[model samples]
Target: MKNSGEELHFRMDLGDSIEAREQSMISFYKRQRVDWTAPLTCTLEGDAAIGDGVKRHCLSSVMSKLQFGFEWKIGAGKTLLFEGEKDHLVPAASQVFVDSDLFVVAGRMIGHSFLHNGPCLTGLSQAVIHVLGGGMPEMASIDIEDCCDTDVREAVELLKGSAELTADQKRSIQSLASGWDLPGVTEENRRWLTEKILFHAVLSRSKGQVKQLRKGLKETQVLDLVTKRPDTLPLLFPRSCAVLYSPQLLLERIIWPAESDSGDETDDTSLEEKCRISGFLREYIENASSQCLQELLKFWHGWEVPPKELYVEVVHGLMPRSSTCMETLRLPSHYISYDAFREALNAAISSVPTGFGLV
Candidate 1:
């Protein structure tokens, strides 16, 4: 692969075999820009030599033969692309890899490797290899159908037949469809279309008429979330989109490391701290009204929690506007024990003119 400007762009020559890590090729075309930005595209005609499943068994057999001391599992898929044209090709560069460090991509566990030196572990002598690297990476998936031109055409036709749209909405959709010149509808484009259609329909209606439409849209969204089960919702609409609904899931994902072993002797000190904090918060909110959650949702619906400095600046700037501004701005809870909160309150209180000198 060669770097073309800001991004790496490489083309696979049609009928030329480029050995990728595994399953990295999204859809091969004969020397074409991937989407629109990729500088080079390559196409390989035949299947991988090892394939995904066969590689796994082969790797397992080799590792068992070596008696490597750790249980290993291969990740979903990774691609390693080797340098060569259709006629002349060679294996990619290979390096020695620890058993724990080396995992299979796709189903195939095939790699050009040998037992070397002291470890008596499987090692890559000379070959290009790719596998899921360490640490969690944010992932998103688009269906194969979503990328097909036929699917886009059908979706466009369905939109054309939709009778619920206003004249303006229909026109806007037509305009959007005309400009979607790409062969297939990408996930981004699909999301845009979905959002735009709803947006137009909502805006075109009067206030009362929009309510039912909004409700319907919300129901459909919830159904999609429940049925399809996305890890995270696409940010289709700024204020109206449904995000991941479970705080527990978020907490576990953010706090607890994935693909790790936990032994009785191994203590998660951070987890203990988090548990303590969570317990206190749970106890504090036990007597809180149900409306507390609703109020929080309402407050954050159209706004994000600002950074501490920005929040302090905004509070300080606004405090001087009215003598009773503090009284007017009633928090859901009148009291909270936090240093920044206290500081902001003190600043606001101090800014209000008082006959007695400022504390």
Candidate 2:
């Protein structure tokens, strides 16, 4: 993705890459002109056994760190992000988020990923994206589903679901409201309380965190474009539709190996065998659920971000493996039937706990 034959190098380890990435970004930010447009060329340390770079293998590994909160090397680590309703990602509200400077790190990641044509942070709550893009908290269009905290969601539901509340429920609601300096639950203000609770759960609670995110985005200069053109939000933080990995999409992106130009009949049988295995993959993709589609994409190319093409090769091996650096899937042609192929691919995909590396 680097147009000028230029790439930046950083050392990373799978376990400590987040810390490594933080330092790398910190170094970049220290530069007088933080160039957001340049592509990242990363190489992993401690992965001498795994090795890095297919151009993408290490880059994907590092960029993958941008999506979630880093479990700090110090005490009481944080899971910077959590899933909300419909599995959209929303920032978690914790002092640790601010303390770790996750907002700053995440913004740089988003911008770098975007510019490098790597993964985009998909399925982010639209409301949160609005806030990160500099929309006011009060102006954020949030849904009850966007609130990831169970207690808060439940409290809001109870307030809205029934007029009468049990004593315990009432106290719970009051305590939650009190934490945010909102009014106690009363017959006359149920509507107001429900609204405020929803607001508090989604935006108010993360006010400082989101503020830092905006500051971070400004450092990347992505905020400058987002504020200037609201439509660009979908590119950085895409909605569900923009990220749907349909069977056809995957099938189309695949770059099948070219047939040998020589008229070697031996190559004919091997090409047939490869296509047969590919048939299994095609059928598997055809019926896969959205989650499975993502798993396959991740297995094939590191993160689920769609690439222009995914190079596929049939190999004489016992198992399937992918190189995100080269955007290639080395499929072992050992399986003779569809079920065997499916099972192998499934196991291979599951082995990667994170989308980028093997477990």
lDDT of each: 0.26, 0.70
Worst 10 residues of 1 by lDDT: 125-134
The list of candidate 1 runs beyond 4 A from truth reads 1-241, 244-249, 252-274, 278-359
- The prediction achieving the highest lDDT against the true structure is 2
| Model 2: pairs clashing at backbone N, Cα or C within 3 Å | 54-325, 56-325, 57-325, 69-80
Compose the digit string of candidate 1's lDDT tens values, residues 147-201. 2234333445445453455566555556655553322234345555653433222
lDDT by residue (1-359, candidate 2, tens digit) is 33564455554444654566556545554454455555555655445324333334544544555555444443456444444554357776767767867666667767666666667776788788888887877887777788888898889889888659889989999999998899889888998889888888888777787787777677667788899999998887877677777888888888776566145444543767777877777789899988799878877776677789888777677788777667788788778888888888898888654334442
Best by TM-score: 2
What is candidate 1's TM-score against the reference?
A: 0.16
What's the distance in Å from true for residue 64, model 2?
4.0
RMSD of each candidate? Answer: 25.9, 4.5
True lDDT of residue 212, candidate 2: 74
